[model samples]
Target: MLGRMGRPGLIGLAARTAVVAGTATAVSGGIASHQANKANQAAEAQAWEAQQQQAAMNAAAAQAVAAQQAAAPAPQATAGGGSDLMAQLNQLAQLHAQGILSDEEFAAGKAKLLA
Candidate 1:
């Protein structure tokens, strides 16, 4: 009887040890997975913030370009001296002949040049 009781006690102790080790492994794995998920979430949030900042920078650059365009002077209709009226008239006549300019537009341009 003493031998049989000793055997049962040893078996029970081994089973308890196995159950404790399994529970500890499961808890540790769960904790590690939770920590990894938190880290991933943090990384994702940082990426989102960076993307927003880049978008803001791009918008600022575009606004600066628009401001520069608005502040700059417009180009002149003719590049040379303003006194060359005959040459301009001839160019207009050619454009009218080529059908690039309508009759009314040609007349208006001629009037503007004469004025």
Candidate 2:
């Protein structure tokens, strides 16, 4: 049997076993690394999508506020002796007396009404 198989047969068998084990370990490690990277990429994509949705929602809310402001009616200015002006003046005086309006604000409103 030794003559047929030669002296190097045992060493060659050990070398082949080592090579197979090493190859299997390397391939398994590569596959695991690839799967982890794919998972990370998916997580990043989900986070980015969420961020985009939040931004779009914020933009829509801002646009809604601006549209509401634009569509609202402006305060109608009245000429002298009109009930509206007198009512506004009375309200301003009340607010000032209540301390809701500062002295400067009250003075400015009085000047504007007189002007």
Candidate 3:
């Protein structure tokens, strides 16, 4: 048989359903937020690793350039008066004084002057 108070019973049922649905939504949103935070942290870690790799590559490139410069011979000075070599030596000294050239460069240039 049909219930005597049908409308009130239906309304109460609808309200209870709405409350259960809201609770489920809140729980799902919490889980989604947690997942998003984890993804962000992983991305940040990857970015940091990439930066470190790039820094290492840059250091290696600089070392290679220094090695090449060291291996190459210095230009021969002009035979007229030894003035060209003297000028180059003076310039090297100035660079050393200004902290532009390292000790290795100064020594190499000086050795070239003697030879």
State which candidate has the highest lDDT: 3
Query: 6-112 in candidate 1: lDDT tens per residue?
Result: 44586788999999999999999999999999999999999999999988866665565457446755434677656466766786688668765668767886886
RMSD, one per candidate, in order: 14.3, 11.3, 8.1
**Tens digits of per-residue lDDT for model 2 on 1-115?**
3355556588788999999999999999999999999999999999999999988866665565447436755447745557867776786688668765568767886787667
lDDT of 2: 0.75
How many clashes does each candidate structure show, in the order listed? 0, 0, 0
Alpha carbon lDDT of each predicted model: 0.74, 0.75, 0.77
Q: Which of the numbered candidates is closest to the native, going by highest TM-score?
A: 1
TM-scores of all candidate predictions against the true structure: 0.59, 0.54, 0.56
Model 3 C-alpha RMSD to native: 8.1
Per residue, candidate 3 scores C-alpha lDDT tens digits across 1-115 of: 9666645577788999999999999999999999999999999999999999988866665565467557756666556857866776787788678755668867986896677
Candidate number with the higher lDDT (1 or 3): 3
Global fold similarity of model 1 (TM-score): 0.59
